[model samples]
Target: MSDVLRQWQALTASLPVKALGLAAWLLAMALVFGLLERRFPIRPQRFLRQRLAQDVGYYFLGGLVPPFLTVAATAALVWFASGLVPASFYAWVASLPFAVRVGAMVLLGDVAFYWAHRWSHENEWLWRMHAVHHSPTELDWLVNTRAHPLDLVFARAVSAVPIVVLGIRQGNDGLDAAVAVYLALTTLWAFFVHTNVRWHLGWLEQVVVTPAFHHWHHANLPGTLSRNYASLFPWIDRVFGTYHLPARQFPTTYGADRELPQTLGAQLASPFRKPPS
Candidate 1:
């Protein structure tokens, strides 16, 4: 209990630094993707499009809040998981080279994220939470931050928990570094894929996710909702039979057909609220 409280205190103390780091990332992404969208837009629009303020609200709320919740959620999961896995496995994992561990984490985390994202679409209750992310009619880098805290926590935990569970339980800095690398890769890629920039990197698209690939996932058209579920790697979707990309084409429309609450507070409360009778 003392350890948990100490950790919580440390985490709270670090919020300012974390929030500033996220702000830097958000600003850099906005500048880079903002310029790309302006130069070669899939759908030409202003920097401050409709609902920009709401998405910005989600940026801080979704970005700042989830780490706190995910730590608790993943800590519980890691406790149970560590007990199930043998000590030898973690020792072996800890023994591996730093680059190897990072590569392994990236592959493992991406696969977990693929299924978690797909489940969010297939499951009704999860969709209610995830719908907040898809509520935007416009697609841009800022929109990537527009996710419900529950949605953010769920997706993050599914990927992060397993990695932590399989990681060096004795607090090896290598495992810690590897997990950081995996997160950096996924976080930057998520924003890139959500950007409004019209990019289709020929053969390279097969290796990594691109805006065109993920834009189809956000497509409002029927039958396309279930496609492009992978975040970092397209091969996961290919293996799972969810990959869908067409040459010289992008989603004509964005966002879900179903109505979601428009405001941040309402959207946060929406998942728990019953629908109109």
Candidate 2:
């Protein structure tokens, strides 16, 4: 146990060391999920020609960089836009109890995300950016992070960042705690929904977004395209008339109808390329 303690001590000694620890944790989680997929894969061919490198690149970029940039850019924008929103408006939010404030923050974030996600589908130019996420042919936990930078930024701005920035501006003491809890909750949920676990939560599917539910959103097959946009709550999709969770069914196909570029660089640039006639 002395060696283990020494390794732990070394890992915590510096910021880079801590990051290496995180990278190790991430790899372990990937291995765990990969094992789970092998045992309980939703599709039989889930492992066939695994796009390991392409997805790992996106997993890091989308999971780490985009979210950090979202918070940073939001903080900057809120600083500039603070003059527009009266201090009294957010002063009230700052005064709420911890539980209530986090609850409100989550709702505000989810609502913003819901609308922005819908807009990504409805707007063509936005779809170009959003398509990178839907280009996956296989469904698994790692696919959750395969989003475009624009897609991640836009969604965060619409949902979580606004509430967070407001909390920061309003002098909320628990903003850090709230943001951490919220990100934790969201990251867990995102991975859960993208999982290869063959689950169908009989009644709860009506309330929450499940892997089966989101698989439909990624489904490019007949009667399964461009629907189920809610990130956490399925009821929001019901309200918006985009919800379509067929009983005891998963999408047969997983990808956009058209082919997206295979390389990470090319996929990033594909959004900017003009659609071929």
Candidate 3:
């Protein structure tokens, strides 16, 4: 108990540093993406549009997202996959060169994330939680932060748990560093793909996911929902038969069909409540 208390205190001690770092990163993202959107927006929108404040709230909330996701994913992994795989396998994977492990993790994580993301759309209960993210009528880089923490945990755990289970183990700084790189890559890419910029990458869209590909995933229009679930790679969606990108086109509308709570507190609590009749 004393050990646990020490760890908790240590974590709390680090919050200010983490929060400062996050604030700096957020400021940079706003400058870069904000300029891009203002110059080449897919859809015209104000710099300070409606719900901007709420999304800014989400920005800070998003900083806490990864740790919770990691904890939930690790706990789930130990609960489910414990004793299923040999210890030697994890050690062998961890023994690989740092670059190799990071490369493998990016591929493995995206594949896992693709299926998990698709399942969130297919599963009714998951959709209720995910709907909070989809409730935004406007899309931008900030929109990436607007997610239900529970939904974020569940969908990400499917990908994250496997990475934790199959590769990264505790106490190995090298493996831990690799996972951190993977997380940074995926998280930055998410912000890019959700940005409102109109600059399409042409053939690169086929290679990696672009705003065009992911915006379609967020499209609330008829026949556009549930396509393009892969977060990093576009091929995963193609392999899974969920890819749906059109040439020189973009989604006309964005958001979920159902009405969702607009405020942060209400959005967080929404998943546990029944939908209005």
Best by TM-score: 1
TM-score per prediction, in order, is 0.93, 0.85, 0.91
Residue 181 C-alpha lDDT in model 1 = 65
CA error at residue 235 for candidate 2, angstroms: 0.4
Candidate with better TM-score, 1 vs 3:
1
Candidate 2 stretches greater than 4 Å from native: 1-22, 46-48, 161-169
Which candidate's lDDT is highest?
1
lDDT of 3 by residue, 1-277 (tens): 3544565566668888989998999999999999999999998899889998888888887675556445645665775665787878877876777767667778888899888788878888788888888888788999999887777777777877666777555346576776677678778989999999887798899899999998998998876678898888899988978889989788889998789986789988987888987
Q: Assess candidate 2 and give its lDDT.
A: 0.76
lDDT of 2 by residue, 1-277 (tens): 3544554455346546545655785687678877877787888654534786777777656654564556555666666657677878678767777777667777777877888998987788788889888888888888887888878888877775667556632554766776787787788789879888888888899878988899989997875666888888888888888888888888777887667777888888887898787
Candidates' lDDT values, in order? 0.83, 0.76, 0.81
lDDT, residue 6, model 2: 55
**Residue 113 of model 1, lDDT score:** 88
Clashes found in each candidate (C-alpha, N, C closer than 3 A)? 0, 0, 0
Candidates sorted by TM-score, best first: 1, 3, 2
Q: Which stretches of candidate 1 lie over 4 Å from their true place?
A: 168-173
Tens-place lDDT digits, model 1, residues 103-154: 7778887899898999998998898898888888888888898888999889
